[model samples]
Target chain A: MARLSRLVLERLMRYYRFLTETAAKEAVETITSGEIAEALEIDPTQVRKDFAAVGLIGMGRVGFDVCEACRAIRVTLGFNRSYEAVLVGTGHLGGALLAYPNFVRYGMRIVAAFDNDKQKIGQTVAGQIVKPMRMLKPFIKRRKIRLAILTTPAHVSQMLADRLVAAGVKAIWNFTPTGLAVPPDVLVRNEHISIGLAEIAYHLKDQAAC
Target chain B: MARLSRLVLERLMRYYRFLTETAAKEAVETITSGEIAEALEIDPTQVRKDFAAVGLIGMGRVGFDVCEACRAIRVTLGFNRSYEAVLVGTGHLGGALLAYPNFVRYGMRIVAAFDNDKQKIGQTVAGQIVKPMRMLKPFIKRRKIRLAILTTPAHVSQMLADRLVAAGVKAIWNFTPTGLAVPPDVLVRNEHISIGLAEIAYHLKDQAAC
Candidate 1:
């Protein structure tokens, strides 16, 4: 398999999501690359390139089997296996993600959530008990947790990230606006909602012109 | 001014965010292009191009004034004016965004949120009252709302989007998995958190190989 660029991987995820949703409808057993492209507003060639990179072969005219394509993307993206992860900082954003019902469908489960707020500590959020920050290291070590969702504030985000890294977390899904400094060995995916909002703002600007 | 591409606008928003954060820290008055590039993990040339596109000028050695750069990006991206938008589907995701304290900082505000759930109608999520879906049309029309945040379930997303469009929404900040079908004049920005998560999953896959 070729090393996929971040852009390709991100698009592949969108494709996978579209496929999964289509499969759920159960109205179409097979869907063509063209159909997926049209639905996603992506170019057909780009869709084909992404599918080919993942070694998925769509039938020439009949299109790709919905079940097969979904499984292939799941396997390729490592969503076939469930991952045990912890959520740090059980604030509004953290709690919302914790309560997200689709996390399990994506083969990831936030088994625990931690917070430093005394009022929030010991409270169960979305079926997980909120533990003290001190438990993060011990919990990671005992459970062999590999993924950490960092929703800490910007001031302490890097500090918490460093601690998570030292505690042996391999990937940190950052929700803070601050950029995290992690070693090359550790992976970081920053989910900044404002970036998307800004895109909408610009698009709205264009619409206003029209 | 030349029309900005979606890619460039997104990056410019990022630059704006970085500048705002720098200004908030109060440590730096003027920051060099090199510093912005380092902090954002973007190329200095790319930063220069983005700044030029927005008609912003940085000092020779001191770099760009944080406040000035932020204002420039805001004005260029249409963030100079705070937009009045509505939030559809006051579920966990919708409610989280509604409760988000920094929407105004980004130059947008959720003036109202609509939900079909009888139990939720009239209750306040965030600062706005959770109005019934029946009020969506009249509320938007009366307020001349040009933007909407769609966080509705996949099943009703398109139906609701159609109504929103008919109600005069110019743009939709969609958080649903469903791909919206809007007229060319109406814009949609889909913020799928799973895309970011899948990228992290793939990167974790690659790291495990090592």
Candidate 2:
């Protein structure tokens, strides 16, 4: 399969969510592209294209099998395999992520959390005992953990990220405001909280202008 | 100013963050589009266009004034004026949001938090005492609140959103996986955590394919 664009990947996640929800709620065995498009407000042709890109096909008039569609998406997006992730910065945001119930559903798990603060070290947060920063490198090496979630302050995030990369972390889910400098092979997904605030602020300003 | 596209708005926020950070860290009076673009890995021409869209102009040699650029982004993104927002559902995510340090810097204040849980009603989570669900309508009406951050469970999100819309909310920052059905006048920004997971999983799989 060709590389999926970021927009298409996002839409596929939405479709996966919709299909799983529909399958759980209703006894429907099949659904058409039109139904999925309507539920997601996506163009029907685009839905068909996305489905086809993921190697999904529908019958002549019976539409696509719901179970088959879900399986295809799961395999395409690599959600069928579980990923173990270690989270740094046991702050409120980190705690929230640790407690988040949907990560398991998405096949990602936060197996451990780390903090530099002596007070937070050894404390249990959302069922995961917080470890000191000293243990991060050894833990990642022992577990061969490739994914690291960075929620530390902006100033220290870069240093921590360098350590994670040097310790064999290939992917970093950055929740800090500062941009990270990582190698070409490493994937750093920056989840900027302020982007949402900016969008809301802009929309409110636009509405007030009208 | 003409309406900015979503991509442009997001880029503007990045510029704003970079400018503010530079102003604090250095004594630089001006910054070039190339400099901003390099720091963000955005195209220089696109950075210039974004600056122009926000009414910022750079000198031929000296470049744009750092403080002026920050002010322009703040005003263009509606960060100059403060917005009062109410939060629904005081979950761990909600607590993380309440503790987030950047919202105030971006001109948003979570004036209150509401939850239907009996135990959480009177308890304070991150300075704001959690209020009962019954207080949501009256408080919003009394304060004329127009923004709401929803962190409720998926099952109750739509019903809560309906109540929020009736209570005079114009924008909703939804953190649930469930799609919300709001009035045409209300804007819902769905922050799907699963989207990030999907992206990470796909990239990991893509790398393995190679």
Candidate 3:
């Protein structure tokens, strides 16, 4: 299978979510690219292309099998197995993510949370006890944890990323505003909260201009 | 200025963040597009184009004035003015966002939080007391709020969005998994947490395959 671009992967993930919901709620056996496209407000041709990219075929007018398409997306996106991850920075945002119910559905399980604050250390959050920063390296090594979710403050995020990488964590889901520098082999997916704000601000600005 | 695409807006936001930090921490007088691109891992040409699009001119060798560039980005992205927004749902995620300190920096102020849960109604999460759902409509109308930050459950998000639209919210920062159906005039930005998981999962899978 070819490596999918980030944009394509995002669309695929949306399709996967839509298909799964359609299958669960409506119990529909098959759905056309047009139906999925309409629901997602995506171009029908793009939907068909994405489906074909994942080896899913439509039966002309009969459309693609919903269950089959879901399975294909799941396999293509590597959601068949579970991924154990650790969470750093047991702040409000971190706590929100820890308590979030959807990570398990997406094949992620945050097994531990770490914080440098002595007050937060040993406190339980969403079933995982917050450990001190000192334990992070040993914990990652023992569990062979490859993923770390960094929700720490901007100033410390890069430092924590370095520590996480040195401890063998290969992928980081950075929720901080700080940009991290990691090795070529490491994957850093930054979730910038400000980007959303920028979009909203721009829209509001545009409206005011109008 | 012409309308910027979402991609351009996102890049502009990153540049704005970088420029602001550089100005504040290093007190840099001038910064080249190459410098910004290097820090952001973006193409220097693209950075220059973005700056140009925002009506910022760079000196031949001295580069663009750092503070000037920041101001241009701030005005372009509409971060120059403050925006009042209301957050729906006072769960951990909602609380986290309510307590988020950077929103002010990005020109967003979550003035109030609302939830249907009776227990959360009178409780204060982050200085602002959680208001009841019944009060949401009147509050938005009274304040003439144009933006709403939705952190509600997936099932209730669309319904609440409909109410928000009726109450005069022009933009919605949706944090739910459910895609909202709003009027064409209204803008909805869906923040899907699963997309990040999908990216991480794909990367991990690709590594395993290699």
Candidate 4:
């Protein structure tokens, strides 16, 4: 499978949430791609094309049930159960991520946090202890956590990622300024605040200029 | 003018920095969109189109000078100066946003924080006190702050936004889950962590599924 563009990934999440809610309501049996398009404000052709590319096919024109489609997407997304993630940096941002409530909404939770700071070490955030960086491997293995959130600084992002990869982290949600260069096998999604804010500032300027 | 996408806005900051370095070297005079395309790994035509859409046109063959293009983008982005923002919600995420150093890098800085928590009301983070929520209006107005970073919980987001909007805030970067329905004139951006994380999870699954 080719890596989906960030925009596509963002929209796919909405589709999943809509499907989940529709499933809960018990109003769906067979859903046409056009129905999804109508609900999501996307082109119907796009709906059919994207799902077909995902290798899921509903009965030709009979369509797919909301529950079945969501199940397929959920399974393909490895979201059948809660995902365990470890925070690589126990800094302010990392602490905030631990406290963020939305992770549990998607059945994902931070299982532990790692830091070299003595003051934060041994402290618990969101009920997960701030462990020494040395404990990363054993804790991740024990918890079967393959997802890691990298909130470390720009300078250390690469080094930290190297360590996490060595410790068996398969995916990272990177918030650092550093554009990580990871192996093809590792999955990384950049959500750097610096970039996000910069983008906003740029738009503000455009608005003002207009 | 067309609305600028978030990704382009963020890249404009990099463009600014690159132009500064180019100017300092005293070697770069006229620059082509192709050069920017090469440096940023963006398509040259795409770069030209974005700039063109903003009403900043480059000569067909002469292109644009690095410094000139940077200045044009800054003026268009309202970053020719600075914007002071206050963090609402002195919780961990708000505190972290207040402390982020790169906030200054893009000419926007968090000047203070506000929260309703009694204990945190007088406490200081990032050298700024956590003020009582009641003072949001006066302080924000007195400081002429129009842009803010909202880190409050979803349930309280509307109330907080209402207060901020009344306080004269025109734009908000919301870190909450709920998408706010602001006035058409007001800009509300949701910084949804769950959606972001879930997108990454889905991508990871997509890669593995195939």
Query: Who wins the DockQ comparison?
Result: 3
Model 4: which residue pairs collide? A31-A64, A199-B9, A199-B10, A205-B76, A205-B77, A205-B78
Whole-model lDDT values for every prediction: 0.86, 0.91, 0.91, 0.76
TM-score for each prediction?
0.95, 0.98, 0.98, 0.78
CAPRI quality band, candidate 1: medium
Ranking 1 against 2 by lDDT, winner: 2
Docking class of 3: high
TM-score for chain A in each prediction: 0.93, 0.97, 0.98, 0.82
Give the C-alpha lDDT of model 1: 0.86
Q: Tell me the spans in candidate 2 whose CA falls farther than 4 Å from its real position.
A: none
Pitting candidate 1 against candidate 3, the one with the higher TM-score is 3
Angstrom error of the Cα, residue B101, model 1: value is 1.1
lDDT (tens digit, per residue) of candidate 3 on B89-203: 9998899998988888878889999999988889889999999999999999999899999988889888999999999999999989888888998999988766888889999
Q: List pairs with backbone clashes in candidate 3.
A: none
Residue A22 Cα positional deviation in candidate 3, in Å, after optimal superposition: 0.8
Off by over 4 Å in 1: A206-210
- The residue-by-residue lDDT of candidate 4 on A64-141, one tens digit each, is 766767776666555765678888887789888888766675667787889888888998877788899888888887
Model 4 bad stretches (over 4 Å): A1-6, A15-73, A137-144, A206-210, B1-7, B17-40, B44-72, B206-210
Which residue window of length 10 is worst by lDDT in model 4 chain B? Answer: B201-210
Score residue A68 of candidate 2 by CA lDDT: 97
